[model samples]
Target: MQALLKNDVFDGNDGCQYRVVKTSSPNTGWVINLSRAHSWPVERDFGVLRSHSRVATQSTACAKLPDFAFYSEKARNRANAAYEVIKPLILNADGSENDDILDERKRNRLVLARADELDISKTTIYGYLHKWWSQGQSKYVLIPGSARNGQNQTSGTSGRGRMPGDGRYSVFQMGAEDIKRAKEFLEKRYIKKEHASLKGVHIDLIAKHYSFRDGNGDLVKRPEGEHPSIHQLRHVLKTLFTPEDVKRGKKGDKNFDRENKPMTGSSLEEAVAPGHIYELDATIFDTFLVAEANRHHIIGKPTLYLIYDRKTRLIVGFYLGLENASWTGAMLAILSLAEDKRALCEKYGHPYDPAHWPADGVFPAKFLGDRGEMASRNSDRICDGMEATISNTQSLLPITKGVVEAGFHAAHCAIKDMAPGYEPPMEAVKRRAKKYHLDAALTLEECTSLILGQIIKHNTTAMENYPLSPAQVLAGWNAIPTQLWKQELELNGCAGANYTYDYLHLQLLPRTTDDPKSKKAKVTQQGIEFENCIYKSVDDDPTVRQWMVNAGMGKSPEVHCSYDLRLVDNIIVHDSKGRTFPCTLAKDSGRFSGYSFAEVEYIIVKERRAKKLLEDKTNQAEMSRRQRAQAITTRAIAATKQAATSAARSARKADTAAERDAEKSRLRRLQTSMPPTNSESKRVGNVIALHSSDHVEGCAHQQPKIPVEDAAERPRSTIDDLLRRKAQEKTNELTHL
Candidate 1:
């Protein structure tokens, strides 16, 4: 007992100092010697503030304060007013009549002298009694009129208050008419194709109608008129209409939905333990990350995929990369959740004691996500393999899993006041009308470190409405998740849920084979080529290829290969049992060697941006080339439809100037062969009949062939007839001349 003599001073929850009168056994607790009667068992030795005040109401330090019933100061003030006004009526007898006596006094009242304690009058006390008696003595009915029907976020003045939607003064006795005109003007003048200026409404009002009217029936313009003042009207509009009302239909649908979409559906069913329901969600982090090679070279915003714990408001795992929400990012996050993060923290130079982030080996019974990546085919197979059921939330509804959504909100709030390199929220971006990439200052590694620190800080923070801090849920008291998770694992076995890194990795990735049913990869001595890159099998010997050939169902069985789309550097090779035997890469994979999938995509995206800028000017030449190709195609199409008979007819037309030259050359050859018959035979007329058989053959192509019976029926004896005909033609020509 002597040990408690000097250090017997104790601090109560109300911040009061008390002397310990007596010690007690462990179960009974200690007793405060002070008449205040504050006694309780000691909690964790985290230290508490001490105060000299006896009354808890007098304590100023929050550390010295205790968790108590939430008593409204406004309600207490009303109660005090009612008590002051009703005290005299409860005991209005003379002072000599023992009105202050407790034994002979009124019920629920300590004394009538309490009225003099506060500034109360006998007349006011009588009024309060009459009102309470009229309202059946309801405690709420006794509230002061001044404090009744109070609302927050409204226009309430200290001494005098204006009605809602009113400016400095009450603009209108009613709200409907004033609100109607204001809304109509806002919709017509502000929300338009040309986007009328917001201030135009004031100008229109001034030009169209004045505030007051004169005795001569002329409109008068005065500041003290009946109509609302310019400033007051502007205030009303500000209080009523938001920027979204004016900017609707002028922005992307997704942007609008993100900002204004209503949250629907209840949260995921409460789970029994940790990892029973893993909420998977992803979003574009509102910060720019830079490349390692160039600090100022921003890589735009990165997508952050989080595996959140629903039961514990704790983030189980996350994956950040310059890729969109796809199977690769989702799988990477899942893989991170299943593995030990000690190495991960060490790689980032973070002081990870594993006492605050106990997230590994917590296999989920079900995975919850929205329609995007959660509905993907690959995600379905991976979750199935892990014995995790997949639940897809309704489209555009992220509130179905409020824990993760709240986690994202917490993260953004933590970084809202950070330095440059963080992207502005949509409102700021809309005002500036530009992206925040140019303002980037944080490198990828630096931002990642900051994020890790935030995750740790958030997990350790003591949250309200929770049994324990997120860290302590898995850890012990004053211990975080990192330590608690390991402690739980040590005490309890695997709990029928465990997976190896290799096994989980293979299952999370998509697979394709060379089988006839599937688009299989061809196995060769060099390697298997996929995604414009080669992936060599470490065991691609002749024996393996032959085994693939002979041990197959069909004539030539194909090799099944699985690869992570985010990294083409390597792919896992699956044997007949679907077990991964080797991880391989291209033989000469110079540039692509050990490159992340996002890095490759970055290169392609950068080049495409450059190409687009260049093409705006080069498009004319490209158009011309396209036109030329199209013209040639059209001509070829027309030529293909030409008839063979028509083409031969045109080819046989050798009776032009070139045909005459060919005839002369033929005649010269005939003259040489016939010994010229004489010099006269070499003349033009004799050259014509030199080869009658040749003339007949040349004319045969131009003439139509008649049947032998028709020719025979025409005429016979042509020699003498020909001589008579020639003589007759000569005689007719002379007669006609």
Candidate 2:
């Protein structure tokens, strides 16, 4: 037998359950009938309860309490307010209640006083107290039972009276036939990609079924009193369909699946330890930033790639850069997972203790991310290199990586007030004069520093709602991210794998050559060539240095190399033994020293285009000059043939050598006396005379004429003439014989 105590519920022999509201003594107490018909308590004798065999403890007799979570927030709030009214009479710090307050006479007075003070009837107060005691003394019991019982099931003016409209327009109540028609209209017209409005559908329905034709065959609308109003149609539609069903119909299946589907579980549910799962995601910062090198150059908004741990809600690593969300940015963010937190903070100018952000150099067991970057082949390389798993959420489904997605929003909100050039919301932007970009002031480095400060603050701040395990709670672990991470690591064993930066950089960063499919980068006298840039081997690596020397001797070997598109200044070269050697940009390739792979490629393309255009112009000019020279040469040959024919005709009668000589002299004098020809002048321009006596008449400029004797006075000139004369004499002798 269960001992009778205050608030103990038991089954009564009269087929009714009763609660011991107050215990006066061991054998006697005051009990209340739990039935809603009775509100007052009656005296009971516990001594006589042993005699009744049917009377036994019935704690389960009370109705099961409703889960407050299922009810609307407003209903729960109202229930709490009602509970506050009778809390003073029923509850106390100690278990015992005042005997005077429990007396029937005083209890009635108190209930009446509370009801009057709260502007409610005393019967309402009594009902509240009965429910509180009958249902395990919980405040949620006071929530209205009507919603749970499915009462008040009237719709569309059945209980709501007349709809809102002008008095001239009569309102109509929706009948069963009218509701059926409205549902048909919703399915056929309202639920579509076009998303027709409910009012439009209602009007169309009225025109189709609630209108009459006139004598001229024109359709006339029926009186407002004869058809249901749009409000009635809407109420019927809501009752027939759920919000999700309506959303699915209006937005279509794809959109409904993407945006309106219910979430089954949390991202943290599977994360058993600190580094069990890490979510990688990227978002463009809501503020514009300036270039690090040139502050006047607005770089636009930078993309922030964040890696968040699911278990501890700690920001494991992140990358902030001008690069858009791509494999390069994702790789940088992943690389930061193994970076020293102290160095990172100090470099960003936010000095902090190592313990404050202790989740450094910890690689997650699994990497989860959206499909954009994580779906690429480069991510596959991470899986193979680190021996870890890579998972991508369904396309267009970001809820799978909700932890990182929410982290981005929280980070943005945290820094919105401090960040300069922050973009206002769309509503506020309409009211502002200047655009967000125009207000840009922070450089990329400065913005990165601000973000680092926020990350440190997030890691150190206590998360009151964080779910801690029983063991963690017993071990006195707070909800701070850093503390939780450390405690989890100690209890569950570190889920992070150990890795060196050099190894991760070599394995994770992109590796490319002139040939996209080729793994080896060619070494030439110009240095190691990769993506159209030259890289020289570092001095520390003797093997790479020897390879560079061999390259100079025309015995270069193709070596494997990896590089980050974000920073092309240096690359990692894998040698024969699988050792990584650092290589830097050669001096000759200084133009691409500080540029990214994308920028270098862009500049190369532009230069190639400009060179191509210049080469085309040069080719056109060469073709024009060649044509002009050919024309001039052809005219000179024609002039020579005409001059030879005239001289031959004049010397036809002179057969002897002396006569031939006299004729040549006469022709030479005639040529000198005549003015320059038009073709000659146009071709060579006017000539200048060396002496005044040698000038010719009727010429723009005269050619200087030197006598044979003056020409023979020069030593080299006499030698050329003697050789010609001797050869002519021998020819004359041979002809005479």
Candidate 3:
């Protein structure tokens, strides 16, 4: 085929030579386009040239070509088998191989004998041997009538499809204005802040005057002919866009980077020893955990912090929290690794054996963690205090700390997956669709025990990539992790030298400021206050109190204090001279006796906020009630005063009426001596009308004959005063009086 296609010329059926120009593959067979042959004189090999009258004729010969063949693994294996059988038979003619000569007769005899012994025909063995020598002793060869590339099959061209970030123009093709309208409909109806379903977007697009351009670039509309179907458009969308593309287009780059971007894998092949490197990370346990104290109350998911030994892939230690990840969890995990867990095991009802958990009090040479809780300044300081090299994994690269990451996944599979409230990845969505935690059955204590058992089983079982389990690899014992660690320790250990592992862990705990305003750590008569509790150094231990007493005497101006986040009952304080003092929880800390720092802190914050909220609500309700009471009281007071004033007015009206009658009788007696006037009859109509009476002058001459004591001591009634003043109101007498 290569020879035929590369040719510059080919003969036509008319005996005319044509120049081959181009070739292409279409729905039809291979077609060749050619130009007219040039007019060139032909020369004959014969002594005399024949004229056109001779009318010479010639014929072309053809032979059958075999199907395409190449050197495959099967063919190579067959040839190699034959060669192996015949290789021992071939010996040099001279015993010296350096002579590069072989006895052909001897070789032929040996080859035939070997073939007969192997039940292979003599001819086949000879053919294989001949081909081997002819092909420079190459065992593998391709024998065929047709040519083949002898390489893996290939399409020879890339597939016809859009790139990942490509648009589906061909799928939704139309005029610019129509396309714009379709996009507006899609975005407004589907891809906005409130996400909608794919079917919604499809229905919306189909409702518009949409058109499509097919693979052949012919525009078709629903009104004119057949448009792109929803299924076809869906296929185009899924093919043209990627998860990251949709993430960016629908949401934003942040979502695409956080959720859709691919993460690379990591390897532990570089690890050299069990205690060389350890990975630390925290994760939300998939299963819901109930309160240990009460099994019926589900506590939600737990934050599990694991310390994984990179070399052996052993879980050195772990810390489990109630429902969240925090720096305290990280500290507790380290504490678990540094201190013996016998008491913990006894508490949890797991068998206690130092040999089975040898890594209990050992620290690794290096600590690795992500840029979260483990990357804090306190964490760094703790690592420094413990003399371990601390390193942070690359941000967004979960694989850098792959050992812990994998450990978390393994634990989830071995334990969390089996729990009733188990939630897989994207569990939030599943949880929203159906409540899973509501059916939680395992309490924190029960869950912890199950997890411990799973870890122990993992440490003893063989791993896919490892010949032995992590425990076996670390301790060189086919037992639990603790046993392996213990056996290895009999030979060598590298946790620390100058100080004990417990002390080292204590050194890394969060430190408190010595500043006076942070009075929680101040050493008062009741001892130091921390987290609303008091911690006092007992004098029973002279060594411990010496640091305190010395610091008290102004021997040191500053003190260093660090508390184990794992325990709220105790804290370690180092004086300026570096003397260590252990402080115990004071009696005032009755409520916080057995609580961990994390638990206590969480409780304090939650309770405080809850109390604050309740107080605010109470205050608001009280103020509202007070305002209502004040409004009611104000109306009552005003009515009472109005009632009192109306009573006073009635009393004054009675007094005036009595005084007016008395004055009118006196005036009538006075009018008896004189002629009675028309105005006199109405003179005492009311005390206020007395001033308008014509008998005012006659009444003005008469004075009331009352006891002096009564006049001087008795207060005047309003009516009597009105009568008296009216009687004195005569024109001339009024001015004098």
Candidate 4:
């Protein structure tokens, strides 16, 4: 194995094809033969040999008996029976299996024929024959030569393997050149927005229109009809249009002028400036929800509004709560452009009277928007109102609004599909619509702010092919003015025809002892609670208070109210008193505009010393006590360590004394002497005396030492001596007799 691998015998682009055999030593009987074929011909030949011929050839002994080899009765009988059972199963010329022959009923019938008894079950016969068939018993079957032999039973085109594209449409079919040419023609003829433009019709419509007789009046083949795909159109436009065309289109509506002048012949063809066009449309937001505590229900839906902007697509205004955004809402949203300009003025401390603004101040001279009912039928009522408001700023005619009506159709086409979903719920749709409004709103305060922030981003960061954010493009325009517009601001001591600002009416708040005197509670005319609040009004006349009450500013005479309202610069209400406080303009707070929510704690964090001072003294004292406790614990730990060392030394000393005493006791016990001499002498004497006195009584060698009779006469003697004396006396009497 190692030698073959090292020689690269099996390494080839094609997989290993040749067979390798393994053997144990040189034994022929202990060999394993493995075979493989690289091609189908070789594989089929081997398969035929194994399945049909049994791979057998005649030996010399069998060759001499050729006539009898296959002619024997047993062999002929087996061949006839196999042919009868297998002839019906001969494979056809086609490469498909003979499913009918392989069916269970047919196979069962074939098996039953060979069995002599008609009653023999097909299952039993199949089992009997199948076992032998699996073991390469080919003699029990017959092989038909090739499927070609049965051509009559098969059909045309034998499924000998084939590859794709070998069939129909071999020549003269539409190819890549036709597609390329058609695309080139479309590019030259159409407008190039990602969305469909006025110039490009649906492909199906175009094809049908062109399908009519050609100039030669001959029948022409028509290509399949299709919609002009946005992808295909974009590619064609990119190839055909120059960057200048795109830049011109982006500048804005070429139809109207900033002075509300309709463009003349040349101006119609000329590019409108970037800041001249503002389109407005509304989309609903899906996720907007407002809970109604009174009804325990939610007012959840999207609302419509429009975007007001110049050609820069800077957002200038947005109107909310246009319930049923019909013609009314559309008009309202449009009208907000002037209001936005006014608000910007008041915020800048400038005269917000609409008559004072430049001709281009309010909004784009031409409005581009959807054709909702509100937008479509914008009436004299709406126009006259706008005219009256802007009459103070400029006497621009309102006819310019006509230029944007037609643009609504294009806006619908561009925006509706781009909304969140296909016919999304109104809420989501409205929100998406507001994105355009938001873009327009940014233009209201300072067009430059949006341009600097987003216009730069769109150009530098985003793909140039797509439109940049209004802010992105605006960023390149110019630095923004710091002022914002405002409206209805109360003047400082300036008397109007019927009204004037009044001194603040102070409402003393009920106080508890817990409340600090320095912290005076304040409540606005709106009944909103305020703390440490103060405001100044320009008017100090008492009649001003009566005028304010008449105008819904001061406390109601019939009903108790929290406080009386007085007007100020930007504040909705004034809170200063005339005598004790003497209303005066706040130098530091004069520019304050909107209410904002902030965390008091968060602001206090900027003053570290104040924050530390605010900490409770009790807590500080407790912390100091805890530190002292920790210090005492450190000292106690040191004392414990010293005591532990002393105890350890004392224990070691006691252990050493105990060990010494134990050793001494063991030595003393070992040194103690035994009385061996005296004990040994006594024992030896006793043993020697006992051995010499063996003839005294009942001795083996001697009869008696002291007479047995004498011993027996002494009754106090032991029983043994008495018995021995009796026996001796009897022996003596016998001798005497």
Candidate 5:
């Protein structure tokens, strides 16, 4: 015979099932009739007694309890309230009924005392106790008979009426025919692309069906009291279709399917272990960011690509950049999955122990992402090289990658309030003007640090509602992503694939030669040139050197290469034999280092525009200067030609070398001895005047005289002395002749 355990159900020889609610002794216990009928006499049996003799003859079976989830909140509350009334009598400290209360007189006295304190009859309290003891000794069994029947307690409109305080409106009870008509009107007019209002549709229904023609054969509205209210129509509409169905009708199938569809399964359903499946998705952050080079220049919101582990809910990898959602950004994010977490965190200035984020170098068996990135032809590298399958979500349906989508929301919420240049809500924007870009304070690197911190926090913190497997629960594994990942890896023996970072990076990076539309990198005398930036062979690879030699020999060698747009510092150049060579940015292209390919391209374009504008202004100034010089030269040439006409050619020729020299000397001396010009005298006089009242005295008429000693001490001009010496020599030559 099986031992009678507390709460164990057993079959008695009397053809009734009993539950052991309490053990009174080693061989005896108090039992309750689990299969008791409502018509059974409660007082005739003060519960049942189970002994060793009864257990020896009876069979035991597992008890099947009711699922209270289906019960309404009111029903559950009523059951709990009734249980509170008899709790002290039935339940002891350890959840078993007290043996002292097993006596009929003692139990009745307690019941009567409870009834009197609660202002209820003793019979009512007895009924609650009998129901609790007869129905498996559960609080759920204390629910009222009407609620347990699963039928409306009141029959046919007994409790149905206009709610209290509803202004003098008449209550119009809708019949079957009225309901059918209302559903038709709602489906045709309200729940449609037109999105008609409920009140408007109700009015239209009245105009079409409930209205009568007036004396002049014109349609007229019926009295408000005679028609059903809009609320009645709305209630009928709700009964005919669910909220999702109504949304589908109004917003079209695609919108409802993407946003309003019920999620019956989890993103982890297909994930068997920590790295079984990974979800990838990208979103443009709401806040703006400044450029790493120049904080004054506002770069529009950066796009964040997240690689989320479905099984552990860990953010394995991410990429933050100014680029839009494209394959380039996705490639970087995928590379981050196998990147060193310690290095990545340190690079972003959020360093922590590797144990805190242990998803480094773990590759998922399958990659799931949106069509924008995963659907590209470049994504084939993930399948062919890494041996992983790519699963792309359907277009416009972000819910397919719901795990990563929620991750983006979590990351955004973590930094939204703290981040500078955060975009205000649409309602706030509508209320007042705001330029979020102008408020941008964080650089691209700083934003990346913030996002990294949030990811680390998420990975280390225990997640809410993480569904743990039975094995994990038995082993006491925590819900923290890092802990779950490490525990699962240890138990399951590493479900993720493994590859070196360099090897995987090379395989996954997009190849320019593979793209027909993109220009391949050309090897020239300057080195391998890509995207207008020169990449020289940093490592002495024979293949790269040969290519450079051939390029210098006038052969344009086009090399197949893969490069990360996020980092233009280096690129992987593939030789004809499929061997790769590392190439670094040339000295000339060193300015482009530390900048993304998009930023490099932007810088090039901007610089070109600025240079062109400056050149245009320079050319305009040069042209203006040339025109002014031409005008001055033309005027001087005309004056010289006019003066030549006034001189006689024969008289000029008759003059000897001595006379010519003497004439030049006399002119030089006369010009030097001449008094200062009126403008010059006035300029000097103004300086010596020194008084505002002496304005007239500082004019050309009041020129100051130089003293004889000062004038004599002033040496003759060099030109005048040289002329006098030349004239004396020329005159001596004439006398000797």
Candidate 6:
């Protein structure tokens, strides 16, 4: 309603005059004249170009406008192609047109027209038609009798299109249920099919099930509207289904690539010199030991951490745990190595001390582990209290840690293959650490121990690829000066107590002792309770005896007991036949105060309360039996009285019957006496009263008949009363007797 605004598109002045040019082509163009008062330089109109004459055909005119031709040709061509494909589908219900005859030229023209309307390529329209035709061929069929019945369905009128705004025309061709089923099928297939990738075939299947169409023209086909391709399907799967890492690549891919390089061999040789590098990593074992040594069924799996000298491939230390991999676990393994070193020295009389460690054993310079924080020795004391910088070994390098990483990778692959779908429960992981050893035939404490044993077996036996045992290589290394060899051995053996802290030494306080034999300061006692049941004490030291005595006296001499529980000897209790019972030292009562083996001796042969209980049970049984007998006697007495009552009732009924019979006879006699008066009574009624009046004074009234209850009928009532009276009499008689 608001008019005459001079905007960008229509900038003409209201009062301006213009001249219309009548061209030779019979069309008009306007030229602005700004001489009028209202006219200004801004008076212009661009739409005047449309008023100019141009060619009627789009080809000629479109050529003049190159940009339009550039974009429109493809769009028109695709639209035409889509129209050609849909033309027949729209024309007839059935594809009754010649099957073998494809009119390429006509199809091309139709496709171009469709593309022009839809603004899509002819090729795109062709593709959509091709897919649609492929999918519908089997399902879209017309009944043969429909045409004869006068149903004039049009050509190309297939069940492919829907009314405008119908939900069936959604871009997702398939219904919700069908899509869900498809997704589920693909997921299940992916779970089982290792290398099968989700892509185009799956998408096409979905599109075919539900008919969808793009809206551009009433019947024109869209070139861009086509089924998803393989790439698109893959994108959906990666984005929606698979884990990121699996979709991208495997973990440690880069390290594995580096491992493939030729330089790796040389680097390994240098870094893993006999005692230079020690690799450690944990492996979870799903299988359990088939022996009584580890009899309990593990809830999940056992985690075993192994430390090996890469050069000799000798296991330096090992730890097994039920816990998931942790920093504490890795640290404890190092501690085991330290304890083992001390043990080896004492066991073999360590010909050379720490001064000659290199000669005594294999010593490691570097500690290697996967990216586990506890395994890193970068801190002042890498494992809390552990001395990371030992006297003989050098600090480890970061690159060297990759060895352990490689080991972990190997374990993951191998173990997963052996135990498919197996994952250790947390309980089993925690319990594993409690057990120091597990034996294949018996039990082994550390996985490293098993690895060491295996290495020894492999080297010594002719069963495998290795030519020499790891121990042999270790022996060769040991041939150096006693000092150097012992130093190396000490270093290798000194896995800081952090790794395998279960050893008895870590639990005990370190005490210096003047050896009676060598006059050297040697550890006199070794046992641990807190650090894993280890105990260390000197049996012969006078000071130790004195300390024990004083400690015992502090809490009532009897209450004072041995401090080292692990050192206390194990004892068993058995029956006469020697069957042992599960028993242990009573913790509540201190060792000295608790009853002795002799005092508890009686418990061995007999149950403490069994005899008294048996006697009580017998007495109760006898009392019950006597009470039952008395009840039977009472029942017998009552039955006798009942029988007596029945007899008395029978007798009384017999007497009553006899008395009734006698009464009946007397009544008959009286009847006979009164008979003979029938004729006399008829003669004179006054004559009967003469004799009666004379005898009246002396006559006695005839007695009324008396009714009696039969004795049998009332016998039951009297019987009870009689019995009671009889019992009372019997009681009195018995008292007098």
Q: Quantify all predictions' global Cα lDDT against the true fold.
A: 0.60, 0.77, 0.60, 0.36, 0.77, 0.40
RMSD of 3: 26.0
**Model 3 per-residue lDDT tens digits across residues 627-705:** 9999999999899777675365457566788899898777675643333333664784533322434645556545546
TM-score of each: 0.44, 0.56, 0.44, 0.20, 0.49, 0.27
Candidate 4 vs candidate 6: the lDDT winner is 6
Candidate number with the higher TM-score (1 or 5): 5
Worst 10 residues of 2 by lDDT: 688-697
> What range of 10 consecutive residues in model 1 has the weakest lDDT sum?
40-49
- In order, what is each prediction's RMSD in angstroms? 24.8, 20.8, 26.0, 48.9, 24.7, 35.2
lDDT of 5 at 73: 90
lDDT of 2 at 403: 80
**What's the lDDT for residue 68 in model 5?**
63
Identify the leading candidate in terms of lDDT.
2
Instruction: Please say which candidate is ahead in lDDT: 2 or 6.
Output: 2
Q: Is candidate 5 or candidate 6 better by lDDT?
A: 5
Reference-based TM-score, model 3: 0.44
Estimate, for each residue in 662-708, the C-alpha lDDT of model 4 and write its tens digit: 88666544443322244675777644222322222233323325556
Question: Candidate 4 at residue 94, lDDT?
Answer: 77
Error of 2 at 594 (Å): 2.5
Q: How many residue pairs clash in each candidate?
A: 11, 0, 11, 53, 0, 94
Instruction: Sort by TM-score, best first.
Output: 2, 5, 3, 1, 6, 4
User: How high is the lDDT of residue 286 in model 3?
Assistant: 83
Identify the superior model by lDDT, candidate 1 or candidate 2: 2
Show where candidate 2 strays beyond 4 Å: 1-185, 202-240, 252-264, 288-300, 349-352, 395-398, 426-428, 433-441, 513-529, 534-560, 573-590, 611-619, 632-737
Whichever of 2 and 5 has more TM-score, that candidate is 2
